[model samples]
Structures are given as C-alpha cells and as structure tokens.
Target chain A: MSERPPVPVITPGALARRRLHVMFALDCSGSMRGDRIASLNYAMRSALPELLSVAEDNPEVQVMVQVMRFDTVARWHIDEPTPIEEMEWIDLDAGGETAMGSALAQIGEALDSAEAGPRQLPPVIVLASDGYPTDDIDAGLEQFFSSAAATAATRIAIAIGSNTDLDTLERFMNSPEARLKPLRANNAPDLVKSIKWATTAPVKATSSPTNAPDVASQLALNAEQLEAPSSEVVW
Target chain B: MSWRAGGATAIGASHIRNKRPNQDAFYASPTQQSDPRFMICVADGHGSDAYYRSDIGARLAVEAFIEAISWNLDSPEQINSLPQDIVQIWRRLVKQDIGRNPLPPGFERAPGRASDRDIFEPYGSTLVGVAASEQICIVVQIGDGDLLLGYEDGTINRPLAADTGLHGEQTYSLCLDDAPQRVKYKAIKRTETWPDFVLTSTDGVSKAFVDDAAFVDVVRHYRELVRSGEDLQATINALPDWLRQVSDNGSGDDATLCLASRRYKIQDQ
Candidate 1:
C-alpha cells in the first residue's frame, strides 16, 4: 500500500456561504426636485462600483439590492433584490409630496418572513429623505418595526438639507442600543459623501472576518467623522 | 490498529478582494505505528476586520488543541478540562505571537468604534476537533462547525447539539468573552464494532448542503468510496477537486474536510 501524503489535501467546497440583502429607501418629494434629487441620483449611480467591489471580495456574501422610492406614494424603483453587480440605478425624479410613512410600511411588509425568503444576514436598510413625511409616520413606523427582520435590520437614515425632519429620521432609526445617529448632509457635497459612506462602509465592515459593530453603529461612527471637519471649518 | 487519514484547507472564493488568507485551518497528526491514536482539528476564523489575524489564530488553535490532547492522553479527568486548558494554551500562543508581531496602525480599537479595545480581538476563531483511540472517541467544539461519526451500518451521527439562536452568518468564537463556558464536549466509547470513519469540518463545509440529511448523505458517500478503494492515497488526492465542485455549486466559500477512517479488509474469494 502507498503511504498517504503528510499534508491533508485541502479543497474548496466545505464552507457554506450566505447572502446579504441591502435595500435603499429614497424620498422623491417635490422639495428634492432640484440639486437634492440630482445629487441623490449621482450618488446612487456612482456608489455602484464600490458596492460591486464589496460583493466581489465577499464572494460568499452574495449582495442583493432593492430600491424603493416614496413621494405622494411609495413605489418600487427596483422591487426585486438584484445581484449588486447586475443592479442599474434608475434615475428618480422628485415632484410629489413626501410619503415617508407609506414607504416604511411597504418596506416593513417586504421584510416579513412570509414575503422575504429565508433570513440570510441581517438586511441593511438605507433611507435618504429631504422633508417631513406627509403621510401617517407613526403608523408607518409601527408597521415597519413590527417585523423581526425589519427590527433587526441595520438601518441608516440620511437627512438632506437643514429643513429635513431630524425627528422623523431619528424615529426611523429604531436600534437605540446600537447608538446610531442620523446623518445630516447640508449640501450636495456632504450629501454625496454621506450616501457613499452610508452605503459602502457598513457593507465592507460587516463583510470582514473579524468582530464588527452592527451596521447602525458603524454608520453612526462614520457620520461623526464626516461631521468632524465641518465643526472645525473656519469661515 | 489500522487508520487512514487526509485533510485540506483552502481560501474561500469570496475573500479574494481583501486578499484575506484562508481563515480556516486543519491538522491531522501523522499516524504513528505505535501510538494507535488518530487526531484531527479544524478551525474557522471569525470574519470581521477586528479579527485581522484570525487566519494565524486559527492555525494556533488547531496546533494548541493537538498539543493539549497529547499531553493529557493518560488522564480522563484532564480530558474533561480540555476545553479550558486548550483555550489557555491558545491564548498564551496568541500573546506570544502578538509580542513578536505588533498590531498594525489603527487596529487598537475596532474600526468605527472609539471605545472598543480590539487588541486581542483579531485572534478570534472557531474550533472543532476529534481525538480517537482504539477504545474511545472524543469530540470538542467551540463555535460553528460540523463533527460526525460514520458507523459501519452507513449511518452518520453528529456528536454535538445544534446551536440555537445563532442566526445567519453569526457564530461564537474563541475570542468572545464567554468562550470558555461555551465549549461543547462529547465522548463516545467504542463498541466491538468500531465506527467506519470520523469527520470534522468548519461551517463552510456544512453550509454547502441543502439540509442536515444531505450532509449525512455526503458523509456516507465518502465513507463508501473510501471503503471500496484499495489505493487510499489516490482517493485522498481526488478529494480536493470534488470539494471545490461542492463549493462552486453551493456556498462559494472556502471549504475544508478532514477524514479519518479505519481500514477495511478485503475478503479473499
């Protein structure tokens, strides 16, 4: 009988990888008709490459993206969770009243186990809004947070411009223990930076093999860094 | 005493971007003609930036486990203390490694968290192992992984209980504060009919299966294949490619499997 090799033959198939679901909730209210909407579109479109890079690195973590837009009513700009590499950003126009509440409710329903497939990793939900919700914000948040998946989701809210409702955004961020504060972007540049950071950083951090803070806390830390320079800016 | 053993470790397809080393490590002690004992250990490093050195940590864990077992072979009471003893040895090794290799800049705290002290966090990894002699088989696990015993009757049984509330992609690790308490231990006394094979693997391997039953089928299939073959070395050589296929078609993660089997005698006509 031939002697067995000293080293075990290592193979590639034993690890069972998982998928990560990332959803974007955008506000397409009339207040965001000009630069705000344009910046949001540009940020979303440009951030794709980075997101795809994350997906590529974490091959085990298949990234699926879903886009939801809310104005007079909430609707799916991209209803299905498409692989990050294949996802294309459809530019959204802003012209109707903000329906943040409806959007949240819709997302909450989708997060339900009955509607969503087997829960993979905790889903990442990013919200970008420029105004107060015109609909029933309380009911919407109640419905959204009711689902365990939604409650456990890594939620981040981006408040565009000073006029945006911080209270609504804060309420939307339900993970108090996570210590995540809403990101406030006062201009187009800040908006772009916040969107890119909010979208990509958490994904990259979570995908890492070490212990990582939940997505909410990660975003909060990034928001603090983004705001640091502004506080130091000398006019 | 007759035993045939082979094992392997490879990088996951998804971790290419970070150029992350394969965080999974395995060790199969060379079969000694006199010892009549077989041992194998497999570990998976936690996949978070905080655990930057988890690849090395995993290697340390398996090595430490094997060493701990060898030193306590005569004492069954020491075997009960194996979990704590192994962790202590692993921590000592990690501390020594850290002394030689300082943490890179900005790794003192976990990324994005100001208060978290992540100095030792990078060495976190999950460990699962099996040590078997002619009369007894022992299984120990800390965190997520699969360990099974295949009987001559073509049945595979998992020696460890399922981890509950460990939802999607989350697993306990040796670096966690409560790791010592979380260690699971099982010992099976060998009967007149010895188990056909003993297999231990990290989560990557088990995640590829559709369900637990399917996992058992794969174990049974491997046992049957090994039992049918005369050239044990050739069969071991062929395992890597088959495992790669399983990973490519299933989870696309780094997959590893280690097998220790008892040699079967062929009947003469």
Candidate 2:
C-alpha cells in the first residue's frame, strides 16, 4: 500500500562475497622424515573435504588456503593462496633441523602482505611443529606479527611429538587469545587427528558465527575436551 | 510534506541452518502515520550463545528507538539526549523481561561471554535510527550499520563515520556500558533543502557486496528502482527476497533495509 513511481531498475546479476584466508605451516624437520610426515600428508588430504564442506555451507566468505614448510629453512608449499576447493596438496618432504621461527616469518609475511580490508575476515594460521626451532624464533615472530592482520589472526598449533617445544609454540600463539595450548600428538594417529582439527575448526569459524563472541576461544575450549588420542609414542 | 517508506527483515541463511532466530529487527513508519515525523530504525542483535536473548534485545532496541524519537521528534536541540534515552529505555525493557523470565537454574552462560556478571551481554545489539520531517532530519548510530543520506543530486552522504567494526566482528551495542557516549549523532534542519531520502541497513546487506561504494550504489539503484516502478510498494515488496539472496551467498547473517523518502510521491490507488 504505497505511492506510484517510475519503472524498476535491474540490480547487478551476481552476489559479492568476502574472503577468509586459512594458512598451514607444517614442520618438515628431520624428526618428521618418516611416519610423521606421511601421517601429516594423509591427514591433510583427509581434512580437505571437511574444510571444503564447511566453506561451501557458508558462501559469505571465499575460503582460501596457503601452505608453508620448515626444516633448516621455511618455504612456500602451496606457493599462492588458492580457494579451498582448488587448494591442491602434495606430500611434504622432511629434512634437516627445525626452523620453526623461519616458518612463522614466512607465513606472517604472506598474511601481512595479503592484509585484509574491513570486508575481509582476518586470516587464520595453523602452526605444526615437532621440535624446537634451530632459527631465531623471536626475530621471526616479531617480523610475522608486525602487521594488524597478523595481530588479529586466529593462531593454532599442533605439537607433533613428545619433544615439541611448548614454550616456543606458546610464544607464537600469544596467550589469552590463543586459549588452547598446542594440541599434543605423540603418535601418527594422534598427529592426523590434530592436523584435521587444526585445519577445519578455524576455517569453519571464519564463515559461521557459531553464536559466540570469540569463535577462537570456543574452539580452544572444545579442543580441550576432545577424547585423548592413542597413548603409544609412535612419532 | 507526506513521506513514502517501507522496510523488511529477513533471516540469514546461516541462521536458518543453525536454527538461530533472525537477529535483525526494523521499523519504518507508513506514509499515513498520524505522527508528523517519519521514523525508521534497523537493529542487529549480537546473536551467539552469549546473546541468547538478542532477538528480544533487537526488538526492544527498535521499540526503545521509537520511544526515544517520540520525545525529540520536534525539537532538534534535544537530539543530544536521544542515545541516552534509548539506552535507558532498552535496559529497562530488558530488565523487565529478565524479571519475568529469569536466567534458569544452572543455566550456563556462553563460554566466551565478556564478563559473568554482565547480564546485558545476552542482549547486546547495534542500531541505526532516523527521525525525519520535511524540514529536519536526525540520524543516530550506536554501532556497525550503514546510514546514508541521498540528495536530489546523484551524490550520497554517509551520516556516520567509517566503522572498521562492521558485520559484528566487533561493535558497540545498546547493551554495553557508556553506550550513549559512543553514539555518533547528526542532525540536519533545513527548511529550504533536505536529503531527498534516507537509507539504512544492517551490515548483512553490505556484507553481501564487495565494498562500501558498491553497497551505496546498490542503495542508489533501489531509489532508481522505486522511481521507475509503477508503484513504490512493488519495490518494497521485493526487498525481502533480495535480502534473502544476499544473506544466502554473502554474509549469511540476518539482513534488514529501511528507506524513507519525501521526494517520491505515491499516488493513492
């Protein structure tokens, strides 16, 4: 029940969407050369469908994935940010000493450069490591977290073995915000579970509200209650 | 001096799948209202486990807006107190509702809730409100939503400043402390000239777009749509479906759009 006016104007045909970036920093140190790296590769492949499903369910943000590997040095694994569906994964080669700091710096630099606008969701970073860093972690972290994008990112870590340096991981995952300690995985099966969890949770949070003020904290709380993985130390 | 106005609120796609209620609420006075001023409001409740009561909170925010505008509709100088009045009235309404339905025994709060004692957290919401007469137009915003003033010219003006906190990643809310102090207020009273129309929408509508200019251009297109339509009612009727599509593929959050126009004349059927 309103007044008469002019003819209707056609709107643009396509819907515009925001982007949500998810990155993985895998530890390819010498300790992970055998069963550990193999489990990681398998776990990542298994996790993709679940992540893709979650991303597809919420079309609001274009879910993109980036990957990096670290041993004596860190380098790009995926090379460029790719949509979750198109994010192809290859088995990572394990080598040399842990360069956890170098890995953080590499991913950090990428996020800093790809920096999100008001419409974009802050990037989510998942760090998986099996041992202490052989590189300068403090300097690397400083370089990585210098940007606002890195500052606001959701950071998660996977402790791949009994020898994981919790202190270093904790530094990367600044406390209070990174509510969950590094997800502990002492064996290959546990490693797979940790990787699956690390990949999917934050990606899902990027698209869905989950009815919480802080999805990261909620994820941390849930991760804590997960049933313990196998007790056998197979890593 | 008559006005033409309509508004719509649609449940978001994500909310539908999650079984969450539509957290968006709105009010647009009809052209035939007896009140001299045409008032419009769009409110978005912070819906999550923490804001369990936000749907009600959003409803109350709209009611509070109407209540606040009623007092200051004619007096532009008294506009400074509008935000305070809205907060005062909304909290009172929320308290009354709380007394009627107290938090159940052993009812756990959302884990990420800001503070355990901050009972208002369950009803936090952001709102943009406008009360316009032929001569005076008043706009007030408390959080993350769009408020644009369209002119007879092709240009558009955003009454509120840029807010980095859109789509509720973080935002100010009526339920938060010192809310009135955070409110961004603007009043325009020009007998010779006024905005041709005023447009406001929750962030969900904008989230479906690439950027602010694109979203604003869409608002301009809606105005053109109304101008081109055989009747403004047709355009109004089309909003819900359009918003549904935006939410389905864009923000996946509740969407609401409110428009009030003095420039467009509605021919009575």
Candidate 3:
C-alpha cells in the first residue's frame, strides 16, 4: 500500500489577510434625537451582516470598521479599525450641536497612513447627517482632504431627514467629476436602505479584481437607476 | 528536455453559503505528458454582482492566454507582444461568450452602459500566466497575484512583484478599458542550471502570509518538496488539500497554485 502524503504544517503567517478600512461618521445632534437617532442606530446595526458578507466574499480583503459620532464635540465611538465580524456596535445617543467640522477633522487625522495601518485598501468613508454643521466645514474638509489616503478614499454622504444641508453633504462627496449627489433618506425605511447601500455597495464594487471605476462614478450610476420611478428606494 | 506541470483550484470557504462556483480558474497545456514547451495560466474572477459571469470570464482568460501563446510560439515579435495579443483574443472570446449565453433574466446591467466598453464589465477577471519553451520563459500578468521562480541554489524570488495599491482587493483586470496598458510582461532566459521551478498563484495564497518574506518561505518549502524526489504524483495530488487548509485558516478566498519544474536525470539511476 502507498504511504499517505504528510499533512502540511500550517504556519502562523499563513493566516494573515489584507484589510479594507470602513469608517462611519454619524451626526448625533439634538435634531437627531428620538426616532431619527433610533433609526440611525438600527440601520447601522442591520448593515453589519451585509458588510460581513462582503468581507466573506472577498476573503483576501478583511473589512475593518471605525465609527465616529459628532454632536457638540466629535469623538470616535469605535477608535480602532476592528474587523467587522469581531466589531460590536454600541448605540449612540443624540444631543448637542452639529460639530460636523470637528468630526471631519478627526476623520482626516485618522486617515493618515501613520495613524491607520500603512498597508490597507483605500478606505470607504460614509457621512450620515441630519443637520448642517455648526462649525467651519471648509476648515475640516481641508484638513481631511490634505491626507492623500483620505483623498483617494471612496466618500459617500447620506442626508438624513428633511433638514440636512445637501450643499455641505455634496461638498463632502468631493467627486465633482462623477457628479454623484448626496443620498437622501426621508423616513426610517429610506434611511435604512440608504445606509445599507452606502456601507456595502462601495466595498463590494471596489473590491472587484477588475479596475473598478471610481466609487463616485459607480454611485452616480446607482443613484440614477434607483431614482427611476419604478425603483423601490429613491436615492 | 521535459517538464512536469500541475494546476488546481479550490473554492473559498466563504463561497459555500451561496454555492457560488469557484471564481478562480487555471489551465496547464500539454496535460497528457511532459513536453519541452508548455503554457500555464491562472485567472481570478471579480467577486462583485456586476461581474456575474466572472467565473466564465476567468476560464476564458486562461484559454485565450494558452491559445495566444500557442499561436505565437515561433515568433519572437509576437511573443514579445503577448500581453497585447492575449487581451485582444480575450476580449474577442468574452464577446463571443456573451453572444452565446445571453444575460439571465433581469440581470442588473453594470452602471454607465453607454457603449460596448461597459458590456465587458460583467465578465471582469484578472489574468497571470507564463509560457515556456526549451530556452525561454515569458511571464505576463494583468492584476494581483504572485509569480515566483525557484532556483536550484535554494533561492526563491518573485519574477513580477505583486501590484500594491491602497485597496488590497483592487487589481488590474482584463475587463478594464485600459487593460492593454495595465498588463505587465517579463521574459526570462533559461540557463543551464537555474530557476529549476516556477509557481503562479492568486493573491489568496500570498495574502495568507504575514508578509512577503513569510510567503517566500512557503514557496521555498514547496520548492523543497518538489526537489525532495518523494514521488511527484503524490506532491501534486496533495496540493489541493494543502491549499484548502491554507484558505480555510487564512484568507478564506479561492486559492489556486500552478507549478512547473525542469526535470534532470541522475546518471547513476
């Protein structure tokens, strides 16, 4: 009888996987208190599974998530880029002013390769806000875009509720060439769908083996298709 | 002079949920026996919904690569232009496949379908391969993956560096509009005593390692196995199981490995 081939010993380095950082900057202002904040929390928690699915499909690319909440002050709810499967979402309560500028500044700082891991995919940044900024939006955006990593990041903005400042959100998108408009969510269902789309679509699209067109261009196309009258959710 | 070649691919653990076919594909020409000339190609399909037919695309890519090299074997100019030739043939095959198998009902068209250029989006995949003759070997790659040459002196090195990008998963694919420009090509001349073996694999294997050095060590380990003379058939047969463990514990993505080795006879034997 032939002897069986020896079982190959697995090495420690054999388990290493590449990472994709995904950051969420949420507006937890006074205006977002009650149902709005509740919906945001629910939407984010629900989006976790879909995000994990993306990570599973693209095993070479591990999805690491970071979340920042901004009210009168901006701070990281989850500071480090934690693997999506291992990450736990803590519900954020709403109060205070919309210091979105400060949040953007913080996001910019985190975008630094030194701060984030040097070896990671271009990050996916999703900003969901229900109100305008109470601070210098330009100053924050400038600081954020200064980092080449941040500039290359796929940026998506969600205008939650009717009071959102679309102009500011549009500028945050930073893709004038793609002409992608900010996603709008008028109700709980709309907010959930928009959040789901914002979180998963870019990760899925950008992770393709092909030279995926810019996320902004892809989003613009999605927006057009979703905006059609027959579509379920109007973005 | 003859060669021993074998290639295999395993589905990622993550794909089991949907029962999605293995998105990675590989082909080794002259499968029947050792040949002085042979070609080996491996392709990884884009795992996005937009790339619905990427599995087929990957298979077509390897087939096209083999066909291109086979047709241009005797022509130095055509061999040098393998990158361009492969893409041309690949695009033609993709179009033909699309014509034969129309999109399934209610398939979502990729965004920005204004022209024929967008039509190839569904069949997006990355190609990395090599064609070798008795005297020369050519390596060509369009996207992410590793191609390494193992020398008889126990040194192993990647012929073409893995394309690094801010996004780890993003890579140049054959479906890209600028694929012709993005494809990387390298030609290696075989010496009397060097590069005893060649291995081509998708990112799944390398990404499983902590770093490039660690990956090189794994390749070296394989090189030792091939050189161990413990029965080539056994080594080849055990590769898929070994790769399955690599993916299960590491990247959990589809993994593929194609190997080619130069055989030397022992005068005493």
Candidate 4:
C-alpha cells in the first residue's frame, strides 16, 4: 500500500468546517477598577495559551472568540469571530454603571445572528462581573434565552468578589438541565484558576462528538471544588 | 443485480494522543441465503471520562446488531420488532461481559444489585444499521449515524429520518434510560428500482462538513466516481486512509464509512 501512488479523498474548506465559539462578557464598570480589572485582564491574557492548547487538542473545531464590555452600555470590545490564533487581549479601563443585561442581549444577538445550528458547537459564554447590574438582568436573560441557539449555550459566570450579586449570577448561570453555579475568584490565584477552568472545561465538554447537553454538569460533578467561594468581589 | 459492501474505521487524532481506544466500530456482511442480502452497522461511543468503557459499548452494539438482524431476517413477523431485539441482545451481551469481567473488590456500588439495564451507563453508544434484500431495505437506529441510498437519477434519499430531539453533540444511545422506545426503524420497499448505491456513516463523517447538504454532496461525488468507472475495490481499499485524513483534519473524532453498490448482470441491464 505504501508503494502505490497516494489515493484521493474529499476535504472541506475552512468555511465548511465546524466552529466552537467562546464569548466573554466582561464587566468594565467602575467597580472593576484597580486589582479586580487588573487581575481579570492578567488572568484572561494568561488563559490564551491554555485556550490555544484546547483548540490544538481538538483539530476538528475552529475556536472563535468575541469579547463584550458593558459599562454605561454594552458594546463589542473585540467584535467578530476572531480565530484563536489571531486573538490578542486588550486591557480595558473600568467606568460607568453595570449594563450586564444589555451585555446579555448583545451576546444573545451574536449567537442569533450566526448561521450556526447543529453544525455549530454549542457556544460557551462566560460572564465576568464584580457587581450587580444597573440594568434589568431579568429581561436580558429572557431575551438571551429566547433565542434557541442562545438557550442551548453553556453560559457560565465568574464572580470577582463578595459584593457581586450571587442571585443574579446564579440566574445567568441557570440551566434547565445543567446545575452549574458561578466560579468565584477571591484572589489572583483563584481568578487564574477560574479563568482557566472556564476556558478549558467548556470546550472539552462541548467539542466532543457525542456529548449530552449536560456534559458540563458531569465534568463539574467530578471536579472537587468547581464552585468554591468568595471573590474579594473584584469587578 | 446484487449488493456488495466495504467499510473502514479510524481512531481520532486526540484519541491516539490520549492513549484511548478507537471507540468507533462498524460491521458489514453480505449473504447469499437470499438472492441478494446485505447489512451494515456503525456505532459511535460517547466521549469524556464519564463514559470510560464506551469503546467496548460500541463494539458490542455492532455485534448485537448483526446477531439480531441475522436471526430475525428469516422470520418476517419478528423482523419488524428488531428495535427491541437489537437493544435486548445488546443489553444481554453487556450483562454477560460484566459477569465475566466482574469489577475489582473495592469497586464502588450503591449497596445493592443494580440491574443490567441500570448499570449500563459506561457502555453508552449510538447505533445505526441497515439490512437489505432485493425486495426491501430495513433501517434501525438510536443515534447520530446516517443512512443514504442513491439511484441513477441523481436523487438520494435518507432512509432514516433525523431525530430532532437531538442537538449538537447530544444523541440517543443504546444504553440510555429508554433505548428501545427511542429506537426508530423504517422498511423501504424496492418496488420502483434498486438504488445504484447506498452509504451509511458515523456522525463524525457528517460533522466534518459545514452542513448536511455538503456531506450528501460528498456521497454524490463518490457515486459519480463509480458511475465514471472508478474501480469499487480500489475505492474500498483506500477507504481507511481517506477516513484517517478526515478524522485528523475534518472532525478530530473517530470516523467510519460503509458503502455498497449494485452489480448488474446483462439481463438486469
């Protein structure tokens, strides 16, 4: 067989390839200033290598990322589906009120706008906040979950500190089938760990070929302290 | 005219790196008991550490499928009930395996005897199969694999409908809580014409494409090659390498492809 000429096979283009989208909604409001936002930025930047590791680990999926920041209002910090290789995290200055609800609406719209469905790996959304939303988070949840594509996404949250609204964060992390709670980062170490877990676990759970919607829950069950406590409540 | 087939499976790039088992299995058999009889099956084992022994589950699925179809083929009355038979045979096989390979003494348990069905979690697998004779084609499935039949007219039909209840990587499995109820079966009568070609593949093959349409076109391309006189044996021989490339670059998951073609005699032509 080795001696014979190479045989031909069908191959699809990049456009035809499956994609895994991991969207991040960072709270850049005033409370996230100082150690909070700094740690958030540092941790997020450090997560790039691990995320790259995951994308390399699963060659079949094209990992695309988009970042959203909500202060007085929500807007794309890094808009468009940027391939992981081309991604570079830019630090943000915290200012204004928490518009997390608007952030959700925006994230929902992004998922809605995609032409993706079964061919798309269910998206992983991480909501990082250190404070309560000044906007109506409930309405945002309703709007986000209203989109079937968004509803199926693995939405998770990272609580920056003690002041963060556990109730709202829980609401955002809610799932009809998965019992995932927020990942609280008390210090820089916890921030790094939570960020790494958020970046890797969801990709591993969602990218595989035969996983259930609650695959993340199963992973969470095995992980000893996937949801252990208090962040200084950094933004 | 009669149908003949070939199939191949390749381990995923990641599975190899992780030292994990192939976890994908396929089976095909052609028999002369009838004028023309053919059968093919593909099963995908669930991934992740939770389903640790899914590779064994997938292997048993194909084995059970062949046993069930072969035993029931002669009994038309019992053939329609193959969904139950396949699952029953598969569970029984799992039970027997557990008996022979009993867990180590310290293995954790719920402090009671878990029935064979209740303890079948580690063996979860999704199966799709087809049994065909000159008169009809019987298809049965409980998961993500697909079945397609193509004729000379450029029309291709998927005999087993997509299960809308499933989404993304989620699928019904032979080891689910209610596998039999979820199993779907279809028997298509070959009254109009015999399909020129038939293809059955694991979800990995389809997941590699942008959409279902693109995957179907891949099958169409293969059929067109056959129509243009490319040798069947050559294509079959190359299937392993082709599928390996697909798994390495296309889906990064185990891939399986099985196909058959109708051989025509002068009288049939």
Local lDDT at A38 for model 2: 90
Candidate 1 docking band: acceptable
Docking class of 2: acceptable
Fnat for the candidates in order: 0.23, 0.36, 0.30, 0.42
lDDT of 4 at A86: 93
On the 0 to 100 scale, the lDDT of residue B151 in model 3 is 84
RMSD of each: 5.1, 3.4, 4.4, 3.7
Q: Assess the local accuracy of residue A66 in candidate 4 as a C-alpha lDDT between 0 and 100.
A: 93
The numbered model that scores best in DockQ is 4
What is the lDDT of every predicted structure here?
0.73, 0.77, 0.76, 0.77
The runs of at least 3 residues in candidate 2 whose Cα sits more than 4 Å from the true structure, single-residue gaps closed, are A1-14, A175-180, A209-213, A227-235, B31-35, B108-117, B164-168, B191-193, B227-230
- Can you write out model 3's per-residue Cα lDDT over A1-235, one digit (the tens) per residue? 4363532456665566556789999999999998889989999999999899887777667788999999999999999889898977799999999999999989888878433432345788999998899999999989988877677778889888778899898888877564777887877888888888889988876553333433355557776654422235432
Compared with the true structure, what per-residue lDDT tens digits does model 4 show for residues A15-47? 245789999999999988888788888988999
DockQ of each: 0.25, 0.42, 0.33, 0.45
lDDT, ranked from best to worst: 4, 2, 3, 1
TM-score of each: 0.80, 0.88, 0.82, 0.90
Which ten residues in a row are the worst by lDDT in model 2 chain B?
B108-117
lDDT score for residue B110 of model 4: 26
